[model samples]
Target: MDPLQAAVLQQFFEYPFEIDQTYQQGLAGILANNPSNTVLLNTRVFYFNRLTGSSITVADVLAYKEQSASASESVPPSNSAANDSKEQPNVLTFAQLQELIESGRLDEIPNNKTISGELNSAPPSQSAVSVRRKPWETSNDSSNIMES
Candidate 1:
């Protein structure tokens, strides 16, 4: 495994609850340690699982990175570095990713729509009631009633 990948794994294990923070720390560490490797920096992929609130496996990162690289490679090259810069994938911030996931932009993950629908379609709950009669109170019956 790559040194950066190993470091990422270590950070994630250390702080399992802070997925985004761990990812950011890992990226910063990698960039700090190897500033010259623009390819590594630009090609990195962070696969966050919102449901589990955790980062996915390194294999997922590798897969996404490969996909991103292939997609970028297909685009035509330009003379200007600005154009190349534009071609590079924009790494999504945690907030943006969270918004997208919550907004249902990523349909691959299940959302609460189904649950809401079920709740809406279900019958309303009936409350049970207990009735009590006082000992002094008597039923209206002419035959059983005593003359006053």
Candidate 2:
């Protein structure tokens, strides 16, 4: 077993719930510490199940990492680096956007792309048509009287 794997296991066993993150974070941390270490299969499953409220085998987890690694490796390092810098889109929170919009500085943002647009323009108002209400909702007093 790798020393890093042992350390991660120790950290997990000591205070598992200390981290306020999801099971994925825990799994990522463990794997990142020692990607090739496979000695703690049971521990991995147990930790994942407790954190995620779902079952996951070490093989399943490792397979995903292996696939990701292989896929990444296929791309040349230089191209991958360039693609990473190019592919990442500018992300902003609603509050930040609202600030920009309020300040009338939206035009200052370069390469701004609309993430979404109005889908099916507000279903034409049907004010001309009357909505059918439930029998109880109607103002008929007779309907309120229970019948045998």
lDDT of 1 by residue, 61-137 (tens): 55544554566786433433454354333455457668988897875332224344444767898868766767776
> Where does model 1 exceed 4 Å of error?
1-79, 107-148
Which pairs clash in the backbone of model 1? none
CA RMSD of each candidate after superposition: 15.7, 13.7
Instruction: Count backbone overlaps in model 1.
Output: 0
lDDT of every model, 2 decimals = 0.49, 0.52
TM-score of each: 0.22, 0.27
